[model samples]
Structure formats: structure tokens, C-alpha cells
Target chain A: MSGLAETFAAAAQEQRGVLIGYLPAGYPTHETCVSALTAMVRSGVDVVEVGLPYSDPLMDGPTIQRAVDASLAGGTRIADVLRTVESVAATGAATLVMSYWNPIEQYGARRFAADLAAAGGVGVITPDLTPEEGGEWLAATAEHGLDPVFLVAPSSTDARIAQIAGIGRGFIYAASTMGVTGTRDRVSGSAPQLVARVRTVTKTPVAVGLGVGSAAQAAEVAGYADGVIVGSAFVRRLLDSAGAEPETGVRAVAELAAELAGGVRQRRPRPV
Target chain B: MDPLPDPSGHFGRYGGRFVPEALIAALDELERAYQQARGEPGFTAVLDRLLASYVGRPTPLSDAPRLSEHAGGARLLLKREDLAHTGSHKLNNALGQALLAQSMGKTRIIAETGAGQHGVATATACAALGLECRVYMGEVDTARQALNVARMRMLGAEVVPVGTGSRTLKDAINEAMRDWVTNVADTHYVIGSVMGPHPFPMMVRDFQRVIGVEARRQVLERVGRLPDAVVACVGGGSNAIGMFHPFLPDEGVRLVGYEAAGEGVDTGRHAATMSGGRPGVLHGMRSYLLQDEDGQTVETHSISAGLDYPGVGPEHAWLRDTGRVSYRPVTDDEAMRAMALTSRTEGIIPAIETAHALHGALVLGRELGPEAVIAVSFSGRGDKDMDTAARYFELLDGPP
Candidate 1:
């Protein structure tokens, strides 16, 4: 099994949800990004998604958008992103690239797949490329032995979920809400129902993303979802601590990841 | 060749719903509604009535006899889209989308504008239909086209100034998409052009097809046959695509689209997507776009704010790929010269965006000879361009 699959299987055996952490590549700086992810994985994160920053991040809210913008402004290139992934993957966390489709399409799908795999990255989660348009990318990823994860939304129909399951290689990413990525006051009431719907279509592990921020929220999702994916909250910590010491920001991000991981471990599925 | 976009909403390999998962259901809903509306006669009747009475249809096809003199003996006929109710061709699409929004039981309309022409048009349509209206404009554009901002506000629309990433048309679109994602239940994003994802490119083209439909019949009536060539400016490419669609079946008519070359195509500072770009996805569809090696959208410069965009419509990209239409770049200086020449010769001023079409038509006319008839999409009146034109011509300095 792939490292990503193994990690999810291990967590499932323990009756705990897998904890996934996200950070944009080259955020703050390339070296700092690797350090932060290493710290995150050492403490808790089972999967680390290193974001390849694009200029127009349509799916991201203000928090991730600001970090992406700053990364772009700092001259963070695709090479930098790959380097960050290599460093993070060395820490034994299954690493993936979360990006809009254009960068991969522009970088040449086959070339991107080969480069990413060579850099020790496990897979990619393309937020924009649906099953309908993912044929070429899927072929390329398969050729390079890289997992291709896809997102299924709360608004997705049953037929669409089935189609996504047929094409997606890694665990399916379920957007918890019908909106861009951000920390909300409450997780959408539809998230657990959406996960249930995905299970009806495929036995693949279902990970809930988009609104899992705090430990309590992660625990709430852990009750139903196979994995808890948090992004904007980690970015918010880094952003909020930008003025303080760099070590302070890194520690805060790691500590939050650990706390969320604890929530996933403590909250066992209620006799399901 | 295959009835525009296929069932999957693809224009060749260009157009698709390359958006976030959150927007998928909304796009699906929009596609279903648009398909239903396309079939219903009542919808067409309502749109037709609104087009004829509310937005002013069948705008005249005027012959620019004096302007033809400079076209090296070729005759120039202007499809007077500039004379529409809102002084531009933007009203045609705005009103159609507004009516569609109403049919969907949506009460709020949101749109993004470049030079504010689309904003004013959308605002006017919303006011006419009693719908809530919001227009997103780039911070730079709100300053460059302040008058149009005032025009939109006067028409009872709120203007949102987006201050992000170059602060131009592209950023404005990003903000608008964000708003739509946040308020997808109650709000309808009445996309301003034939760009955006799926249904929008196809839907906006259908709404604006009135331009080519009328122009084709008028030209045949006036010249006793189809014009030898048709020219229009390409921004997000709505106007150009609208003027070219009906003429596609006529094998003899040549379709040409002019993109704004801010300085020159070689200067690396132009909005000429066709002249300098590669195929990539941005703002929901796969199209020809001006982007860097990392697929980041590049900043485009053009004197005409309307033409300062880095991407063209997906259909335009497909058309260019198939050799059905040709796209060329017109420099700022050349477009300005055409604007001045048209004003002096025909006693009619054209918007800077429209002047690019005029410039393209002049070039085509010179090549096609004296017996040739070239139809140009004079897309908007020049009233909005008085300040820029005056400054460029040094008329603002009082007869230099």
C-alpha cells in the first residue's frame, strides 16, 4: 500500500481518525515551511499537505489567500515547493501537494508527477480538477505511481460520488461546507451526512475538510469522518504569530496540530 | 463543427467547470436552468421583449463613407452597437442575464466590471427589474473610470472596490467569484462577458448574438451580399464573439478579432492574450491566458481599461485553434489613431475598446481592396473616453 493508504489504515485500526495538517510551501520562507511541517509531523500530523501557491486561489478564503499571496511575493517557485515537500516527506509524514489545476497543467502533468514523486511527495489533491476533467492527470499520476486524491462536496450527487470514487486513487476529500476554505463558528450540519453519502458509494476512507479548525471541531468531525483535515486554522496561527518570534509561530502551529491529533485519538466512533 | 460546446460544456479542450467543489452544484444548477430557459418559448419572448423595448435592439448599421477613404479604397460599415440604450453592447448581455436571474427566482445580481461599462449596464438592468445589484471593480479601475462608477451608483448599484493582486479586472473577478461562493443561495452572479465557466460563455454568447444576427441581415440588405470581412475588439472576447457567431456559416466572410497591445506585442506589456499566451485554466475555464511559467496570471497593461485583461474567452481559444477566426494585436497608439480618424471623418466617436476594432477593420480593408465591405463592431460610444482621448491627443493642454 502507498504511505498515505498505510497511514489511514493504521489510524483506522486504532479506531481513531487520521490527522492531516496543511501549510503553503515557502510561506514565511522555504526553510521555515519545512521546519514547521517537520515539527507538525513529529508531534501529530499523519499527512502533511504542502500547498503550491498560485496567484488566484479561488477555493481558499482570506487566511490561506493571504499566505499564498505572500509566498508568491517572496518569489516562491515550483522548485521551492518540491524542495519543501522533500524535506517534509523525510520526516515520515505522508506528504501531498494541494494546488489549483493550472499550475500542474502548465508544468506538464507527466513532468509534474515524475518530479513530485522524485521529490518524495506521495500524491496531489487538486481542488479544481473534477473526475470529468481528470483523465489526463490520472493517467500521468498512474504512470509516475503517485496517488490522485479528489474532492467530493456536500452538494455532490450520488452519481457524481460514484464517478469520483472510480477515478480517485487516494482517500476522497469531502468539503464539509458549500463554501471556500475558512474556520467557521460551526461546522456545517451537512458534513456527517455527506460522509455517509460517500460511504454508500465507496468504501474508501472519507476525510472531512474546509471547516475543521479547533480541537473541539476536530473531535466533532472525528466522530463521523475517517480523517480530520485542518488548513486555515494552522495558517491563522502562523499569520497571527507573524509579529512574534519565528520560533513562537512554529511552536504554536505544532502545538495546535498536536491538540487536534489528541482530539482525533480521544474521540472514538460511537459504536459504529 | 459540433454545435458549439458539447454536452459536457467543452469548447474543444478549452471550456469546462474548473472550479472548486463548493461551486459545482451552483454551476450545475445554472446549467440546468439555462438549458430549460433555452427551450421555453416564454423565456425567449420575455428576453426578446426586454431586448427590443428595454435595452433597445436592432441598433442601426451605419456606413462610414468618409472613414472608408482611409481604408485604402475599401468600404467600411459600422454595426452601431455603440448606440444601444446604455451606450455600449454590454447592456445586451446584462439584461439577458438579469432576466434569467429573475426567472430563477433570484433577487440579487452580482457582477465584475473592468471599465465600469458592464457595471453600469448591469446596474441599469437591475434597477429596471427591481433586483438588488452589486458591482465589483478593481481599485485601479474605479479610479481610472470614476465617471462610470458614478454612472453605476446613480443607477442604484453598490460598487465594491477590490484591493488585491494588481487591482485590475482579474482581481475584481476573483472577488466576485468569492462573493458568489459565499452567497450562492440568494445571489446570482451575472457574469459580464463570454469568459467565466461553462454556461456563462455559452449563455452570454446567446444573449449577445443579436449583434451578428442583425448585422448579417442588414449588411446583406445594404450590400446585396455578406461583407468580405468582420472585425471586433476582443477583451474577455464577448463583443467579438457575438459579432462573429452568426457569420460562422458564411464561408466567404472572414472573422478577425483585435486584442489590445498596450505598447506592442513585443514589449511584454500588452493584454494581447492571443499574441502572447499559452493554454491554461483561470477564472473557471481553460482558455488562452497571459500567465508566467508558474501559471501565475501576469499583469496586463492597456490604455483602454476595458481591454486590460489577461485572458480571452474559451470559445475564442477554440476558434483560434481551429483556424475559424484570426486574432491580431492593435497597439495603443494605433487604436487611438483609429478613434481620432473615425471621429474626424465620420463625425462619430468610439470607445477606446471599440477603436481597436476600427483599427483592425482599417487594416483588413486596406488588404481586401476597394470593392470589399468590412463590418466593424463599434461596440460603444466614445463619451466614456473623452478624458483619455483628450489627454492622448494633447487637446486637454489646449491646442498644443
Candidate 2:
């Protein structure tokens, strides 16, 4: 099994869902990002998604988009992202890169896959790359012994789910509800159904993301999902703590990760 | 040439769906609705009638004898899409998309605009069709093209200024895509240009191709032959593709597209995508894009808000690669000069976007010499660009 699958298996053995955290590679500065990500892992995040900031982030809300914009402004190139992955993976958590497709394509699919694998990264979750346009990416990942993750939206048909699950090597990223990446007042009505439908097709673990803001929401998602992913909420914390001491930002992220980690552990069984 | 964009919407690997899975269902639905609409007499009849009665179609190809004489003596004919409803060619695609949305039972329409021309056109179409309309425009564009922003509001559409990523056309597109992803169930995204994912490029091209079709017929009847060259300005390349597609089979006629070179092609700020960029994926299509070594889309500048974009239409990229057409850059100064020249010589004020093509006609005219008959796609009028023109000519002080 891939490291991502093994991470999910380990979480399943704990009778709880995995806690996933996301942070742009070079928000504010690269050193601060590494310290914060390391803090997240130490605080019990089972998987780390180091964001590769792109100029156009269509799926992100204002908070994440602003953070990404600052990251790009700070000159966080592809190498910095890889260096980030290498640092975070040293903590022994499953590490993945979440990026738009253009950067990877520009980096040469084969080269990017090979470099990512060498950096100890386990997978990639590309939001913009559909299966139709994923030929070269799929080949590169397969050759590099790395898993590729694809997102399944609430609007995705059953056939699309099946097709995505069939080729997806790691856990399927289930975007909770609709809309871009942001915090919402409530969990989506469609999350449980999307997970259940995904269950009928592939046994690969399902991780729910998008709009998961707090520990309570995390708990709610963990009740049905194998992984509870939080992005904008974590980004909101870091963004708010942007100018404070580096330790303050790290502490803020650590506190939230610990809270969310507790949320996953306290979730009731899947009600099976 | 052999009816491009095969069943899957791949124009030789340049066009396809590169969007997130969340928007795929909407794209599929649109493709289905459009496929049905094009085949049914009920749909085509309504669209055609609207084009004739409302949009003032078959806009005349005006003869510009003085302008021709100024361009080294080539006979010049301008396809006056500027005469269309909403003062631009944008209404052609907007009406078609609004109609398609109505057919699909969608009541809300969303769009992204650069110069607010598309925003106004979409607003006008929605008002005519009795649907809710919202437009996203870049903050910078909103400030520069405030006239169009007001026009869209007067036409009953809500204008949302997007404040992100250079605050330009690409940012507006990003914001609109976000809104569409959220409201896909009840809304239709009317992409203003022949860019983006499948179905949009094909559909917008089909809607705007009426320009070339009418121009070709008009040119044949008046001049007794096809023009030696056809020129159009390209941003996301809707008007250019519309003007070039019908003439693809006319092997002897040259197809030329001019891109906005803000200062100069070498200046990093210019939006000369095909002239200065390489093939990459952006805005849901694989096309020639202005991006950095790390693949981040670079900020682009142009005097004309409409042509300030980082990517071009995928079909234009394919055509450039296959040598079926040629793309060059026209600097901001060149377009401004052409805008003035056209107004003075032809007594017509052309949009800065269309002025790029007019400048291309000047250069191509000089190259091909006296007997050459050159056709230009005058895509929009300069009414909305008066502010920019005024600022450019220093007429801001009430013209002295």
C-alpha cells in the first residue's frame, strides 16, 4: 500500500479519522512555513498538504487566495515547495502537494513526479487536472511510485466517481458540499451521501475537505469520513497571525491542529 | 479545416476540460443543451430572429477609401460588428448563451468581463430574456471602464468588482469561475470569449462566426473576390476566431491576428501572449500563455482593458502552431495612433481592441501594396473607450 493508504489504515486502526492540514509553502516566509508545518505534525496532523501557490486560484476563497497571493509575491518557486515537502516528510507523516496543473506541467510531468518522490512526498491532489487531461501526470506518478489523488465533488455523477476511484491510488478527496475553499457556518448536507456513494465504489479511504472550519465541524466530518481535511480555517489562523512573532503563528496552528485532532478521535463510529 | 474540435472538443490537443470535477456536470449539461439547440429548428429560429431584429445583424461592411489610401494604397473594407447591439460583437455570444441557458431551464446568468463590453452585452441579453444577471469585472477595469460598468447596471445586472491577482481580466475570470462553481445548479456561466473549457470555445466561436460569414459574402458581392488578407485583434480570441474560421478554406487569403503589446513584446508587462509566450495550461484550456519559469501567470498590461489578458484561445494556438495563421503584436502607442488615424481617415472611432487589428491592416497593407484588398474585423465601437482615448490624447482637460 502507498504511504497515504497506510496512513489511512493506521487511522482506521485507531478507530478515528485522520486529521489533514494545509499551508502554502512560502506564506510570509519559507522558514516560518516549515516551522508551522512541523508544529502541525507534532500537534497530531496525520497528513500535511503543502500548497504550491499559483497565480490563479479559482477554487479558493478570499483567505486562501490572499495567502497564496502573498506566497507568490514572496517568490516561493517550485523548488521551495519541494524543499517544504522534504522538511515536513521528515516528521514521518504522509505528505502531499496540492497544486493547480500548470506549474506541474511547466516543470515537466516526469521531472516533477520524480522530484516529488525524491523529496519523500507520497501523493499529489490536483484540483484542476481532470482524468481526461491527466495522461502524462498519471504515467509520471506511476513510474515514480507515487500515488495520485483526485477530488470528487457533490455534483459528480456515479460513473465519474467510479472512474475517479478506479485510477486514484490514494484516498479520494471529497470536497464537502459545494463552492470554493472557505469556512462555512454548517457542514454540508451532501457530505454523508457523497462518502456513502464513494463507499459503494472504492474501498480507498475518503477524505472530506472544503468548508471544514472548526473542531465541531471536524468531528461532524469524521463521523462519516476517513479523513477530515481543513484548509482555509488553518490558513485563516496563519493569515491573521501574519505579522506576529513566528512562534505565535506556529503556536496558533498547533493549537488548532490539536483541537481538530481531538475532534477526529472523539468522533463516534460510522453508525454502521 | 475539416471541421475542427472533434467530438470531445479537442482542437488537436489544445482544448479540453482542465477544470475541477465540481464543474464537470455543468459543462456536460451545457454541451447537451447546446447539441440539442443547434439541431432543432425551434432553437435556431429564435436565435436567428433575435440576431436579425434585435442585434441588427448583417451589419454593413463599410468602405474606407481614405483610410486605404493612408495605408499605402490597399483597398480596405471593415466588417462593422461595432454596429451590433450593446455597441460591440460581445452581444452575439451573450444572446446565444442566454438563450441556451433558458433552454436548459437555468434562470441565473453570470459572466466575467475585461472592458465591461461583455458585461453590458450579457446584461442586455438577460433583460431581454427576463433572467437574473450578474457580472464580475476586475477592479482596475471597473475604474477604467466605469462607463460600461454603469451601462450594465442600467441594464439591470449586478456588477461585482473583483479585487485579486493584478486586478485585471484574468482575475475577473477567476472570480466568475468561483461563482459558477458555487451556483452551477441554477446558473449558467456565459464566458465572454472563445477560451475556457470545452463547449464554451466551440459555442462562442459558432455564435461569432456570423461576422466572417457575412463579411465573406459582402466582400464577394462588392469586390468580386475574397480580400487578400483578413485581420482581427485577439485577446482570448473570440472575434478573431469568428473572423478566421469561415475563411480557413480560402488558402490564398492570409489570416492575421494582432495581440496587445502593452509597451513592447520584450517589456515583460505586455500581453502579447502568442508573440511572447509558450504553450501552457491556463483558464481551463491548453494554449499559449504568458507565464514565468515557475508557471505562475505573469501580470499583463494594456491600454485597452479588453485585451489585457495572459492567455489566448486554444484554436488560435493550434492555428499558430500549424502555420495556418500568423499572430503579431501591436504596441499601446501603435493602437492609439491607429485609433486616431481611423477616426480621422474613416470618420469612425474604433475600440482600442479593434484598433490593434486596424494597425495590423496598416502594416499588412504596406507589405502587400496597392492592389491588395484587406478586410478588418472592426469588433467594437469606441464609445466606451473615450475615457482612455481622452487620457491618451490628453483631452482630459476638455480638449483645450
Candidate 3:
């Protein structure tokens, strides 16, 4: 079974909420990234997403882009990122490699998936890889026991949602906004509506991402999603704590994650 | 023969595949396809037919005698790119890519535009090919160039307003690149200029080189030898390179690149990267870029949206470094004045982006004298700039 499916299954049975934390692999430095992931896992992060930096990170917000740029400038490579994942996975926390499709295509999808699985990565969240073009990677990922997650935006049609959910193995990444990933003043109005729409299609766990930057936003999204993915906010905290104590950044994210996880756990079942 | 721009795609230290690992295979595939297509007679014939019939190529080399007389009687030949279908040289590259896209079995076309010229051109090609088209444009540009936006929509393109950072050309490009990354399977990104990573810069340049190829042949056929100088405006520097590449080996034929000096270079408002900027990497390649201390791209302003860019193409950088081309700045006021002069004398209203080259031609003409033949690439028509021109000249106050 895919590690992502196993993890989600385990979380669903235990009624334990999932906290997905994203960190650019080489931010500050590659050596620092290992410690960062370890700290995130130690601080109650259920799943750690190691971002593979790209030069043109179009879907990212300013904070994530800054982290990507910093990681890229620090000379981070795919090999280094995988190594970081291996080190983080040694701690027993699930690891997910989050990157754009270009980097994966450059690395040869099958080889990359096999290497990622060998490195102990549980899954991948390639936000830019559409389901229509995901056959090779999906097959490779399935072989490696690494789940290939797909994103469904609020604007995604019912047919697209069904297709994505049908093909997706780990969990459905629900983008909260119509545009790129970032922190916003409010969660998209259609996000909850879309989640309800997606629920009608498949039983797959849907993780809401993008604009879930604060505890309030995360909690709000967690009310509807099976998992909550916080990217830009955590990346921003890392940027703020750069050259300072890295644990401070990890702790801040941990507190935010713990708060949101509490909200998901406390959700009352709808009257049947 | 040129040895620098090898099959691997390095243009004299300017162009190469600087993309991340995930896209290497796609780039390699594209490179192979482009190589195969370049050598195929059928492919070339089809492209040629489209260029000739669809884009109305071999755009006239009009001798602007009246404008020449105004420039102190200096000989000025305008490579009339304005007469091309879609009213710009942008169509030439778009049509070539559209053909390639069709051959690749891609049914959707996506493009990024600053002033909407490339978007319109791409939309036109997509319409001709019966392909789905999406164009990303900065919100600011969409507002400034609304008529072009409507024109693109009329050509069956869905215009997506990019409301990202600065809401301009750079943001539009970022969004377009994002779309390409997500939709790489059935979509081909028809990049506008000689920029971007690896194959895009090289491919776009090859498509645009037709401009210089025809211009060079026409100049030679008309004057018996190469003109003394070739000049064109540089934004991402595609048009400049299109006019300069064929004449690179001709030592006597000086190439001049004119850049937009928004207010003035010292005022920190100009888009003249070669004149006032330093070498830095942006949008995939290292080139002369306008950037902050933190390496962030800086905001640029020009009277012409098409010319307002923070970086010049890598080839232009190499040319500048090699001293093969002289890069100079023309102020917004100067370009406007030149536009007026050209319209009045030659009855051809040039886009403000192209007027930079016109301004440069007038300056160089006086210095080189009337006997010196000069070819200036008139990159696009001024119709799209009519709104800005009306505001600039206060035509709204009186005209019905």
C-alpha cells in the first residue's frame, strides 16, 4: 500500500488530524534542512513536506518563493533534497516531497519515484502536475509505495474532481483559491462549497492547502478537509527566524499546527 | 560560420538550459523536435507558406525618403514590420510555434504578453489552427491595452489577467510559465521574445531571424551591398537580434540597439538594461538585468508597455560584451517626438517601442551622413498605442 494511503487510513481510524508542514529543502542550508524537518516532526507535525526548489516557482506566494530562491541560491539539488528526506524519515515521521512538475520531469519520473521511495519518502504533492498527464509518474509512484497526490481547485469542475479523486492515491490537495498559493485575508468563499462537492465524488481524504497561513484559516479549512497543509506561513516563519534560532521557527509552526489539529478533532458530526 | 550557439543551445555564454531537473526531459524533447523540424523540407515549406500567405511576410522595405530628409537628409530604410498581418513581427514567431505545436499534437496554446502584441498574434495563430488559446497578461497592461485584449478575445483567446506582483509583464510571464508547468501535456507555451530558458530563447530567435534574413537580402538586393548600419529597439531584444544576426559577420555593418530611457537613466526609471544595468540572471538566463541589491527584479517604466522590461535577452548581453553591437538609450520624449515626425513625414505611425529605433536612426543618420545607408526595423504598428498617444498629445480635448 502507498505510504500516504496508509498514513491517511491510520489517521482516519485514530480520529487523529494530520498536520502537513512544508519547508524548502535547502533554505538557510541543506544541513539546516535536516534539523528543520526533525524539529517539525518532533514538534507534532504529522507529515513533513520537503520543497524541491525551482527557479520559476509560479504557483507559490512571495514567502514560499523567497524560501525557494534562498534554497536555490544555497545550491540545493534534488539529490540533496532526497538525502534530507531520508534523514528526516529516519525519525519515523512521514515525509512528502512537494515540488513543481518541471524538476520531476528533469529527474526522469520513474527513476525519481524509485529514488524517492528508496530515500524513504512517503508521498509527493506535485501541485503543478495535472492528472491528465500523470500516468507514468502515477505508475512509478504506485510501484514505489509513494502516493501521488493531485490538486483540485475550487474552480475545478465536478468531472475534474471525480477524475482527480479517482486517479489520486494519497489524498486530494484542495486548493482554496482560484489563483496561486498564498496567504489571504479570508478563505475563499467557494472553498467549503467545493469540499462538499468533492465529498460527493470519492471517499479519498482531501487536504486543503493555499491561503491556510494562520491558525484561524487552518482551523476553518480543517473543519472541512481531512488534512491541512500550511506552506507560505511556515516558510515565512522560517524566513523571519533565519540566522536566529531555527527551533524558534519550528516551535511557532508547531503551535499553529497543534491549534488547527485541535479544531479538526473537535468538529461535531453532522446530524444524520 | 557562428560557432558559439551550438546544438546544445548556448549562445556565446548567454543561452543554455538553466532550468530545474524536472523539466530537462521536456526541454530535451523540444530540442530534438525543433532540430528535426528545422531540417525537414516539408516543415520549412509549411512554415514558409504560413509566413508568406498568413502573416503576409516579406514585409516591404519602404524607403522613408521624407523622414530621411527630416533627419538632415540621411538615407533611412524602414523594414516595414508594421505591414505584417496582426500588425507586428510578433506573428512571425507565433505562427512558427503554432505550426510546431500542431505537429507535436498539442491542441492548446498559451502565451504571455506585456502590451498584448504577442497575445494577439498567438491568439490569431491559434484561431487559424483551430486550437484552444489562453493568454496571460498583467492586469495593468490589460487596462492600458484594452483594445488589444478585446482583439485577442475576438481571435478566440481567453485572456487571463494576472494580478500578481506589480501586475505587469513579469507577473504575466510568471503566470504563463505556471500554466505551462501544469498543462505541459496538451499545451505549448508560445513565448513572445528571445528570452526564457534554453530552447525557448533559441527557438523564438530562430523564428524571428526571418526578420533579419529578409531585411539583409532586401538591403543587398536594393543597394548592391549591406547597409552601413542596422538598428532596432531592444526589450527582450528579439527584434534587435532579428535585425542584427544576419549582419554579424559583416564588420563594416554596425548594429545599434536602442533601449527605452523612461524618464532618464539616472532617474532610475529607465528600461535600458544594457546602458545602465549589470549582468544578472532573470527568467532563466544571465543577462543585463535591472535588479535590486537582493537580486529581486526591479520595476521598469517606459512610455511603451512593450519596451518596459527589467532585462535584455542573453544574446544582446553577449553582443554588448563582445562589442559587436552598440547599445544606447532613447528617452520617452525622444521616442514620442520621433513617432510624430515619422507619421507626419512618412505617413507611417510606428509603435512607440519601434520609435526608439527611429530615434536612434535619426541620431546615427546625422552622424553617418546622407550617403550612409541604414536599415531600421519598424517592429510594429502604432494602432495599439493610439489611446496612449491621444492622452500624450491631448487629442481627447478637441477631436471628435
Best by DockQ: 2
Interface RMSD of 3: 9.8
Clashes of 3: 8
Q: Between the candidate structures 1 and 2, which one is better when assessed by TM-score?
A: 2
Off by over 4 Å in 2: A269-272, B396-400
| B98: Cα error in model 3, Å | 0.6
The digit string of per-residue lDDT tens for model 2 on A139-194 reads 99999988899999999999999999988888999998779999999878888999
- Each model's lDDT comes to 0.91, 0.93, 0.82
Angstrom error of the Cα, residue B220, model 2: value is 0.6
Query: What's every prediction's RMSD, in angstroms?
Result: 2.0, 1.5, 10.6
Ranking by DockQ: 2, 1, 3
Ranking by lDDT: 2, 1, 3
Candidate 1 — which pairs collide? Answer: none
lDDT of 3 by residue, B130-173 (tens): 99999999999999999999999998899999876667888888
TM-score against native, each model = 0.97, 0.98, 0.69
For model 2, residues B229-313, the per-residue Cα lDDT tens digits are 9999999999999999999999999999999999999878799999999999998999999999989999999999999999999
Q: Which ten residues in a row have the lowest lDDT in candidate 3 chain B?
A: B17-26
DockQ of each: 0.70, 0.90, 0.07
Q: Name model 1 segments beyond 4 Å from true.
A: A268-272, B397-400
